[model samples]
Target: MNSSVITPIGKILNARDLGKLVRDLREKQGATQADLANFAQTGQRFIVDLEGGKATVRFDKVLQVLNILGVELTATRRK
Candidate 1:
């Protein structure tokens, strides 16, 4: 697998934050956008739009990309 360990993105306050984190992780793994899209079974356009922080992106596709990048999403009660 081309998966890399996902790092903490701290508090993500918006779509851009999530996009940046994904881009960072993908770059850290030295994987091309196309490679990630293929691994995630998505289209290159989706990857591009995602990295550009497209607000209306499908949640399932986002999860697929995150999975391919070995990113795990978690939620907790805000302190």
Candidate 2:
């Protein structure tokens, strides 16, 4: 059986697409939610909600967490 997990991104209300990106990166680094939460200096529940794509996170907090996870954000103009 091949089953894929679909994370909430563009499908949910106020869903942060970056959450999925963070979750993927964390998995690649073999880091647990608790580890990420500690690294991000946030509550584990917050991390869980973020990873689950169920959190209404603030932009600054999102950036902070991304920075803590060593995830850099780059901007580019549309061609």
Most TM-score-accurate candidate: 1
Query: What lDDT tens digits, residue by residue, belong to model 2 across residues 1-79?
Result: 4345333323222455656877887898899988988888888888777877766766676787888876665654556
Where does candidate 2 stray beyond 4 Å? 1-16
Clashing pairs in 2: none
Candidate 1 per-residue lDDT, tens place, 49-74, comes to 89998898899999999989977888
Worst 10 residues of 1 by lDDT: 1-10
Off by over 4 Å in 1: 1-7
After best superposition, candidate 2 residue 2: deviation in angstroms? 40
lDDT for residue 41 in candidate 2, whole number 0-100: 83
Error of 1 at 67 (Å): 0.6
